[model samples]
Target: MADDNKAHTAISFHEAAVAAIEAQKERLVRQVTLLQSKRAYHLSAIRYYKGLITLARRLPPEVLTYIFQICIDLGYPRTPLNVSGVCSEWRKAALAPTLWSNIVVDPDSDERSLQRRIKFRLDRSGLAPLSISLSLSRSAVFMNVLAMLMQHTHRWSSLYLTAESSQEVDHFLGIFGRASFPLLSNIGLRLSFTGGEVPLGVDLQEPPLAFGDAPRLNRLSFHAIIPQSGLFYESLSLLKITSLILATTPRHQDVELLRLFTCLPLLQTLILKSKISIVDGDIGTIAEPVHLSWLRKLDITGEIEMLNLLPFIQTETLSHLHLRAVVPVSEEEQVQGSLADCLHSFIATQGHALEYFELHGFYLSAVHMSSYFTHLPNLVELQLHDSDISDEAIRLFSGPDACCPKLSKLDFRWCGQVTGKAMVSMVQNRLRGSHNLHSINEVTLIHCSFVQEADVLDLAALTICRLLGKPDDYCRGSTCCQNERYRQRLQLRQMFGVGGRVRKLTKNLIL
Candidate 1:
């Protein structure tokens, strides 16, 4: 009787709990159904409101077309045709002349259907100034498209042509005869041979490549091209070019190169290949330095004769000098010191007008820098590339009486001799001391094998943004959010020698 009573009591309690649970479940179901209905209504409202704020309805047709035009001017990714396919108003907006003014045509692509699309774009581009960019290869022969585009030569604002062969580029340029490009302001030509070694040389023995009709051409760039005829060079030099860049192969002799410079009287920026050096005995009496009054920036790259050419060019307005020095295999030993001495003298003669100096591809030692350390007090930015920099140079740079007092940027890449400890000491001297009053605001080290990454992190505490190694190193740029070095920072855990803890870091710890 006692066992039966216990069992009956348990069954009665179980039935009570089940009844309560069923009632609660039904209530929850009704509540969930009402909540779901509310969610669906909210979603429907969002869709309805969003549909009203589209480009066509929110912006006027003319305003929308203007926006599309601005996008094209700023390098829009999609063609205007694709942007217009969304709606009727957009289609009409895409028909604006500005939307199709800047056209890039490639003959190597599907030549038939792409031409039709380009034709439609050209039609929409009616009466607008056209900036034409053409890319051609060795075998590409699209004369019909070229002729069609040339019909708008009067409206060409900028012309950029990249051809794989001299013959191909010459063929395309052959149509310029008797044609006028009245509005052309900029022209960039890259003469690249497909399977040949670069700086590909173009023999300008053929008829002079002419663009004399473009009266307003202010900037010109020629890559890997050599004009054999004085006519070709003379024709281009006649323009009032404000900026000129000549980086080519089959390097011209010093006299031939200097003759080209004498032609351009209005050049404001000149970048040229420097190969031949003027030896002490070779230069007779130094002629008067050529005056380039408007010239402010000079980039002398490729096998530079730092001592030879600088004396012949006088510019009081020069502010930036980027010397990418490729010391000849024969002159590597003395080039750095010789160059340092030469540059100091050059700056002295120019009244120290340089504010930005970049010395690249030379092996620098303490002797190399000792000459110029006190010479350039106005330098604000300095870059040393693939240099043999040492601790002594670093110490002098960070010394109490160091030159370059206004220098805020120090960028060095592939420096093999600089050790991390010296850099740390230099940085620490700047951080803690008040005597030198270190003002270095930015430090960028790229592929310096001896400078440990940890030392760079120490500098990071003081820096606002830091870039380390190649851009492709940090999770292949996945975690480059706001420029954080993920892979490198994680390595700090391993840096905590025997103990496996990440270094306990805090703000002002480097202080």
Candidate 2:
């Protein structure tokens, strides 16, 4: 009986211990479930606060739409597509009609895919005026795209088209000859060749009556194409174009060409690229020089002899003049006399009104330089590129008798003959305020062979100087000169004591 009592007590103790453990396990599971629920709640609160401080989220939908439009205008054609994927609010803003108005079709894209993308854009554009550019070679794809665009001609505000041949150009013009471009304000046409070798002496033919009915057109550009008098001129006159660009080898007589200018009484900017010369014989007396009273900017690319045309043009309000020489180096001497005479005449007539002048790849003698500076007393800026201007000519910018007293900026690029010494002297004299000359505010030197690092540093101390677009304040302690090879050679010579060792080391550097 005593042993039985002991066993029964032990059993009772074991049962009580097992019951306590079960209760503890149930409490722990409840606490763990509560902690997990609290963790998820904290994460949600953190995300909500972060979104409140986000800049893009805080901006109103209207402001977001405006920003998207600016991005598209700045050549980001994929902006709309990318922005829509960022968030729901951005997607709503990107849906604005005007955001998709600039439609530039990619010619290399698959035809079916392009059609779907173009359709999507057009549908989203609503009634917005379109700026369309179709730069495609002659192919079935071209015709198909043209057809698609024709359906929306009435909505075009600007159109740019390119073709590989004159016939293709004619065909494009013919398609639009009868169609109406009610909102078209600008047009650009380019006749590009695959090899870039257009027949040298071929004459341009008169284009068909195209864009004749574009009442709002104000700007026109022609690449490798020339405008001849006839239906094209008649249409152009009706439009009252304000800006014109012609890149061609003009074979017309001077008087006839002048007459063409007279037709456009509203011309404000003219960019002409021609190889100017007498087509057949002496130019007959121009009864009255072409008067372009509203002309403000004139850019001419041709041989220096082309300046002869300046004598026949009267632009009293002209403020900017750019002359680019495209002559062979061998022919420069032969044309020097003609260039001198033309420069004298041009500066005498129009130099007083000029504020900015640029000369490229021309050899200007000391005499011509004197005339230019003397006549252009109002000139404010001067740019010389690939020019053979002598140090003597540069000295004209200084001294007591220096002309162009108002000059404040000088830009020289690829000027092999100009030395850093002359440039430093000119800048010092100008900055000293001698003769009350205006201090030069800026100087730009790029690929100038003879400019040294010391000259650049000296100029930087006095005024703003730019070496290959590296500004003085931004490029201090760095090499600002283009004679790196020559500088390296000198360093190598000093290291080797100017003997066979130096020669061997400088074999790769300039002599």
Candidate 3:
């Protein structure tokens, strides 16, 4: 009886354990089903958001307009009209006034084909100031056809035209005389004579067209039309042109060209490129310098004789000068005397007003460069490309009373003679001794065979840190250095990821 009672108690305990296990399984199954339903709901929500994001209807109206404009700018077939076919919203954006203002017409194109296109663009442009470019060939008929759009000449802001023949030029200029461009501010004209019986010779007694008139024009670039033709000086005198570029014919007399430049008294920047002209009874002498008080930049590239005209130019406000030396093919046709002397005479009138100087494709010795810096005490930037730059020339900046004490930037490109030692000494010395006297900041030593990878490291850290683009005053570790934004930039330069790579790049840059 005792053994039977023990067996029965054991069986009862086993049955209770089985019941507890079954109850736990049911609870877990309900939880699994609940979690699966929540998972399905979350996945469905993700799909819904993805579909909405992919749909074009979700885009803002302004962004859609900009998108349509970019497609037009990229030259879509039929352009602004192409986007119109996409959707009603796109069509509305494409119809904006600015979208239809820029039209390029080929004067050589068949008028039959362009008539419809030009009419469409002009109608679409509405009353907006038109920016038109005419790639004119030797077809006056094209100009006559283009004249149909001349009624809207007052709406023109910018005009660019290329006429290869004399007849084309005559046609292009004829329109401006009849029509007016009150809103025009910029004009670029390229007129060359490749093939044609009509030469550039025109009656000197004939008066010029005032261009009816580009009163607001500030910049003008004319190639193959200067010195050879009086068109620029004759017509441009009325406009207050500040920037003028005259890439004249190769055979223009230097003295005659200089006389033409005197017409623009308000010129702030002048760029000239011309070749030696052969004229009967013409002397190679240049007279006194014409005063251009407002001119600040003069960049001249061509025959070295161009520099001879420097002494004849007096600019009280001139600050930047860049010259590229060229050797004339003829020994008789040479740059009169030394270029240094001519430049010295020009600088004397300006005093320390001339600050930025550059010489490319010019054979400059150490003494020549040193003399220039010595005379122009306020030089802040100097660039020498494909020049005869040596250690001695660069060392001028390292001395106690260096010539360019205010220099902040130096650029040397393909200067084979520039050794690493001289550059290293100048960089290190400028960093230590002349911190107070000079604002020396960055150096660009490119394609310099002597400047090794080691030479670039010293210059790299400063440049990398300068990526934040703080002012030069902030770079001196002054109170501005403590500003949170600048400090963060400094910290960023010191940090490991992209900053570290910028630092490492110094190694490859020197090579």
lDDT of 2 at 73: 71
Give TM-scores for every candidate, taking all chains together and pairing residue i with residue i. 0.65, 0.68, 0.67
Select the stronger candidate by TM-score from 1 and 2. Answer: 2
Candidate 1's C-alpha runs over 4 A off are: 1-100, 124-129, 135-143, 162-180, 190-213, 228-237, 273-290, 304-312, 325-351, 419-438, 449-454, 469-487, 490-511
Q: Which ten residues in a row have the lowest lDDT in candidate 1?
A: 473-482
* Residue 201 CA displacement from its true place in model 3, Å: 6.4
The models' CA-based lDDT, in order, is: 0.66, 0.73, 0.65
- As a whole number from 0 to 100, the lDDT of residue 79 in candidate 3 is 67
Among the numbered candidates, top TM-score falls to: 2
Tell me the lDDT of candidate 1.
0.66
lDDT of 2 by residue, 1-511 (tens): 9999999998889888888888888898888899889989999889878776788878998999999988887689879899999877789989988888888765566776777778788899999999998876556766776688789989999988776666666666777887888899888877666665554322333322577667788888777655555655655566678898877653555565666677787999988887655222244254357888889899888766566777777888888998888763332463376656776787778878899998776766656765677888888998876655668877887888888889998888767778888988898899899997888888887677788755665676677776543333212344543545645655666577664332222222222
Extract clashing residue pairs from model 3: 289-312
Report how far residue 161 has shifted in candidate 2, in Å: 2.5
Candidate 3: stretches off by over 4 Å: 1-100, 107-110, 123-127, 135-145, 164-174, 195-208, 227-236, 274-286, 325-337, 347-351, 433-435, 462-511
